[model samples]
Target: MAKHDLDPNYLDPNYEPVVNRSGNHPFHEVLAARLQRRSVMKGTVGAALASLMGVTLVGCSSDDDDDAADSADSSGGSASAATELGFKAIPVSTANQVVVPEGYSAVPFLPWGTPITGAYPEFQADASNTGAEQEQQVGMHHDGLHFFPIDQKAGGNSSTEGLLVMNHEYINQDALHPNGATAAADNLGVRPEDEVRKEIAAHGVSVVHIKQDSNGTWDLVFGSPFNRRITGGTEMDIRGPLRGYCKLVTRFSPSATETRGTLNNCSMGPTPWGTYLAAEENWHGYFANSEVNPPREQTRHGVGSSSRYDWELAAGGADAYVRFDVTPGLGDPDTDYRNEANTYGYMVEIDPFTPEAKPQKRTALGRFGHEGVIFAPAVEGKPVVCYSGDDSRFEYIYKFVSSQPYSAATAGGYLLDEGTLYVARFNDDGTGEWLSLSLEDDDFAAKVTAANGSMVGDINFTGFADQADVLLNTRLAADIAGATPMDRPEWGAVDPNTGEVYFTLTNNSQRTEGQTDAANPIAENRTGHIIRWSEAGGDHAATSFDWDIFVFAGEQGTETVVDGEAVVTLDDDNIFNSPDGLWFDYNGRLWIQTDGSDAAPYQNNMMLAANPVTREIKRFFVGPVGCEVTGVVTTPDVKTMFVNIQHPEVDWPFGTEGDHPRDATVIVTRDDGGVVGA
Candidate 1:
């Protein structure tokens, strides 16, 4: 475990290594067909595609304050009404500060290392906090988050107070310590036990009770019962199909019903039953396999020979830290840590209001670098449905439909325990289908058996023996089923009004011209795009759907629909790349966040608002240099908005720009007290 032996790319949180070898139809080919079809259409490409997708297009306008106001046909009102952008658009900034539209205020709150429980230790600027202290403080690198109203049980949606829950994606190693992590004096391979513990403590979810004062300032309510930190060492329950599976047996959780901690948690989603869903993205990089050949579960998921942090090599050989190494021992699987890695890579459901509840890993959703899960609007007597995207190059998007119907009074995480997971297959035509990956799917079984001869190095590929196996090896199952390979699918949002599901395909630089398709049309796509699809008959449980390219990042995917027809709608007012985080406010205004490299014109990562009907985008806010603008949510009233600034390169929140940068949440509100995107 020498330093040089470490996987260099593993340390890069944004580096999604290309793991999908499915050879499935790439999205660019679909895009090519879509463009060709548009060429033959008489109307505008936007109008034609909108018609196919059951959407009505309006004249595109970049002005922030368009007076036309009507209800939208997708979910709520007439087809002509589109949500209007009320604020004046702002210019992109390279400054080490936040820039919002005029008449808006941005206040920083709940930064990393801010104590919320335990002894309530104060944050030291030198990063000298101990491992135990970090467990009681806010975690680092905030990502996906949500604000649950405080008085929901009383049937009240209070905007002044609530529980703010967020995911700490990963750590900024260089800034985590006074002088960074210390290696062993004798061997640079081993990390200090205390440092490793602190690092682990900083990688999970944080639930804090926050209150907004009359003056509009927000502060954390220290020592509240609802404030808790579920870190990498926290005990979590294993739920759903793989709960008692043999492959999950480890020295810690021998029953295979529980395991320790959640890692690499990225974006988050809310369950219909008032619970938070934390996505495990890039958790595979934290483990290493020394065996000559690893199981398909690890190999297919990109568990490399070397770990990202060398946690397995922590000093003193404590099982808590050493379990990161999945190398098989001389004893049976239960006697070693080979199955430890299998416990991760699933959507973990946590009840932020119930402090005593254990986080449940919902395995029925299928596991493969989940970016986040967005549930479709629940129907009283219909199946509960949700969608997730595997956040890696060439990976597939997935949909999970619960076997049981939904009921408000009895709904719980158990609803996620039994479901049929389907992988998306985008056809060259405008239509698409959800290919089932369940045990009852004969097509999946046949494909697995047919491809058995060509498959290599998968010791655990037993031809879809059971539902547990299919879920644990979800990427392989989707690959065999001929699912479409997307361009680094990341965060997703479900429009409450239209029932349209939107996903951000964060840039895929690995795509080639030969692999391009309609969903992913760009070759060497540096700036990614957003894709949206509407379920058939407006029913989320429907197997058939229609999809269209919502918008191309940096205007790259906008091909010529007809002669002299300009379909590229992005202008200087709202041009962004790497659209990573997406959310639709209750008003149906789509908020787009960027994690881009901040190329010219796009000075730094920012958040923009887009009108779904008009496809008009306007830059709303710009973040500091070297920071990713992610994890956005608003209070139930939509008057206040919270956005996370992760991994700032220089010192932030304190308004300095030299070093020891801290990730924090910024609160945005209109000075006149109006809706966020009114």
Candidate 2:
């Protein structure tokens, strides 16, 4: 969530190290196989080889084509993919403002610190709001979001009004405090108690009632009952395998059934039964462990000697702030906070419709740096299926299949609490299998034994003690299962029209030529690629699937190297890098967003619309300088879309150049009042 400088040192909160020492098969060879398969499909090796080098299979046309293709139903539900992308591709820009198509409007909404509840404290541009006051305002750095209709029972599609619920991934410390943090610039001194509290309060999710007027203007409903803030200090119930595990036993929750706060939430998903699943990402940097050889759970996750922010070093050393220190003391496990970090890194289920309900951390989903989670369409009598990617270099992608059949009337978070978490093994031959991580399964245990006998790395292939241990150290379990190590797998989305799943492998510059595979074909992949897969027999719970590369991000006229040679390149209209946010509208338009470097032809982060059937992509919108364009959704009517711009370098949307830039939501709509992107 922090500025991704891609540093290897653990000092930066956002630096995700290559902790995977699994020595599994590299994804590079898989790329070669895919090339061979395409060649055979073309019926001529030479012609297909030549065409592959050009890599124009997925073309980006600059022309403003308005061909009516396919579209979904009016309710944003599954329908024929017959709608064509009607907008002209916008050019890349570095200016400190949002740019959209000719017939669209981009308006800023819900900037950080806006009051939504309690005493309705006003936002202070100078950053002088107290921690208590911040609790009543929207949290900072908005990420994944959804618009829940005001009246849920009435088909849940009210475009006029709804509750906008979104995650505040993290805080911009420099702009959060009156004069930056109370600690030294390098963060060396003890932090003031209130400043630490405010920082914690700014790191969760915000739920506020929002509405649209007849003039097409939108604003928050002041003091609505649905308005609420879930911060790092809010108490949450723990469910699934790790609920009462000893490793989760901390002083605050001695019973190990509850924990305080959710941190570093990234992308999100909605349950079929109408709930929000906020994913916790990059949370390992929040805790510090002083032990010379910390437990595998802490060390494996890259929990270092010092935390990103020294909340544990707060002046008063209250229990609330001291819990950030995971260093074990002379006291017993229940007497300290060593296991506090174990309570995080799960998909937290929040019921926005019920403001009084406590959020539940669904542990059935494996614990890792979850970029996001997306569920497959729920079938009345079939088990629920979902996919999540661990957003770390060379980490594995995971899937959770619920044990109970999905029933529309009875579905809830309880189904998520009982499931089997599996890691993906993307074979070089294009076929992939799901490796079970469930400790109760005999086959998985045998695989662990085999890996232990042959393993040769810093990681000890010790067998898992129970399901709780496996879920707590999910990466380790994945390692033993021989899951394919990908190139920093991030957000994933499932196509509503076809059950295919797509994921953005946000760039991994560390990958070498030798590590490149069919799935991750590029060497030193500065510009990432998108990969999609179809489940066997159209079964979401199937153990196998077929995958292929969808698109590779690069600049026009520049050589994009793969396996030590130039093979793929992009065109002017859709040149981009580091694809992060991905989504699919009901009409099946695949929306792709970038969080790339502000270098060369691509000046700022942008979003693009892709026609999945035709393999055509076109630029849609561009954000201000140094801002990551993410979190997108459309009203059921498809007339309006909401996207978030986070941590802009320049002051924007209401601030002068000298003032601090604030993260806010951008509202996009059509001037002619037609469906957006069509």
Candidate 3:
């Protein structure tokens, strides 16, 4: 199978999203004039305007290298007062267990396959869990998560006891199946139905009530009414524009207003009104279309010809596993699962406090492989703006600005339904614009590009007549809007003090030397970088803003320099790469987590803390081998922290080498019980 078949997002993100980079494209001259630049991309850094449209022709350069090097050495921590951090920075490690600063401690909790409620089934220690047993247990490969304070303390948001809600991005069957998975099930030439069932049950989100006692220790409260599991088979409501699209009609819900299950939930966000935004990334992996002519949408998103685990092969039995087959069979629309894939790829919201409430797919946020959603600080009557990233290479960054001013009394999900979705076009010259994807306001001119990618002329591509049309095909809408594609955008973090949005552009190995943008200045960008932007006039609803490279993540010895000066030098205090997950603690400290290669220069993935204002990054915690250092949440008091380790290659936290190492959340707290980072 082609690499794009495994994951469509793996393709080059540096590919110019607009058609004609060769300068001969018809839209080049006309559309260039149509793009109303809010600013001339003028900045002290250089003539960044040349690379603003992702194909800047000018040779832009910066001369702050010597000034930055004179400011701080890589061996030192941030130029800011990062030394005030409660603990010393820990070195990278490839150990079988998690590593924290000397003054901090890590306690593992809620490992996958562990029963959260119901009959209280023991995690089939012998790897003998049935499909039903797995359902009652915690899902696998934990990713983005949050802690909802159930009963809280006065004058604050921190709660000693709360509901812990998290997303299980994908399953790690090696630790799930007794002997692991195999594709060669010759029983009628299909994958074993039982194996497929176990995997399906292991995907989705988990909610459990947890308590931190007077001793500052934390543990799960099993059998609590609030403790529940949301699997890929769980029913969900398809809300907003994409809900009623004719293309979304499936056998499961002929009304096209509902869908079954949420899978590949990667990163997430906590709504101001207290709902969980569990984003579905890599959702296209679950579907396998066997149709001779797959829908263009499916083809664009990389829905495969066969299931990732061949779940479609069990079609002879029941529809339990049949939904994975999105192919348009001979059956009528009311009896086939053809449009099932359309139902996913949106942000699914769950109310942890109300376990009985149905999970909602907020389509107004638009769709793609949503790495996550991050809302700017809320103002009661101000328009609420939420930002999200399309996780594939060359995918655009997006935002949903509510059309109605936010009301504390209004529900978060409904506010999402009536909003304007916009795609970002970042100019190299510090300034960026948000292109409207709304049909009434969107730009539909498509600079025609041949199959070979040469620009032909300014041609009209896809057009929309309503909000649904614009949102249902969000990627196409952004493409028509001429949004600049980025390098695998992952999680985003908003500065509590400034409301600036920072997103991690996870490394893209596909970006070759020939493919380079001013912002994405590196080839094969093995070490990803963080990009930060401030909304115009401090308004999230604004269409344009200023942006710059916050910091280039790399190893200690690697000196990233430009214009006769050192841009960034990674050293012992902060040597990391591939920034993926990002969040801000109450004190205005930004925490960065990595999902980089786990090898020599990098023994393991790590989580780092940075002074966003000072651009100082400090290594805080490192995870066990084979695990991605992802998902983090801190108590308002900053006393207790929750960080997740996913898909560990070693049986860490559980025991020594032989024990089954399941992905789990680990609680980090100052041993002295002082405020974290105090």
Q: Tell me, what's the RMSD of every candidate?
A: 3.7, 5.0, 6.8
Q: Can you give the TM-score per candidate against the true fold?
A: 0.93, 0.91, 0.86
TM-score preference between candidates 2 and 3, better one = 2
Please provide, for model 3 over 1-678, each residue's C-alpha lDDT reduced to its tens digit, 9 standing for 90 to 100.
Answer: 222345444322222123222122121122233233311221111111111223212101112235333434432323344323545667778787889888888888899877887886888665678888888889888999998777532224755888889899886555667766655344546666777778788899999888877766677786799889899889999998777788789887888988888988889999988889999887777788977767656665767686566676763557877887887878787788888888888999998878889999999998788999999988989988899998876677999998788887764678887788888887635578998877566244322122213221232343454667667667766766777767688999998877889999876666565644443334566777777888899888999997766666665444533433333445667767778999988887889999877875667999988766445566888998888989999776777888998888878777523436789999888888876765
Clashes of 2: 15
Q: How accurate is candidate 1 locally (lDDT)?
A: 0.82
Cα lDDT tens digits for candidate 1, 243-330: 9999999999889999999999999899988999999999998898988888888888888887778888898999999999999999
Candidate number of the best TM-score? 1
* Model 2: lDDT of residue 546: 83
List candidate 2 stretches off by more than 4 Å: 1-14, 37-56, 62-81, 184-189, 453-456, 513-522, 558-569, 656-659
If both were scored by lDDT, which would come out higher, candidate 2 or candidate 3?
A: 2
TM-score of the candidate numbered 3?
A: 0.86
Rank the models by TM-score, top first.
1, 2, 3
Top candidate, metric lDDT: 1
Q: For model 3, where is the 10-residue window of minimal lDDT?
A: 42-51
TM-score of candidate 2 against the unseen true structure: 0.91
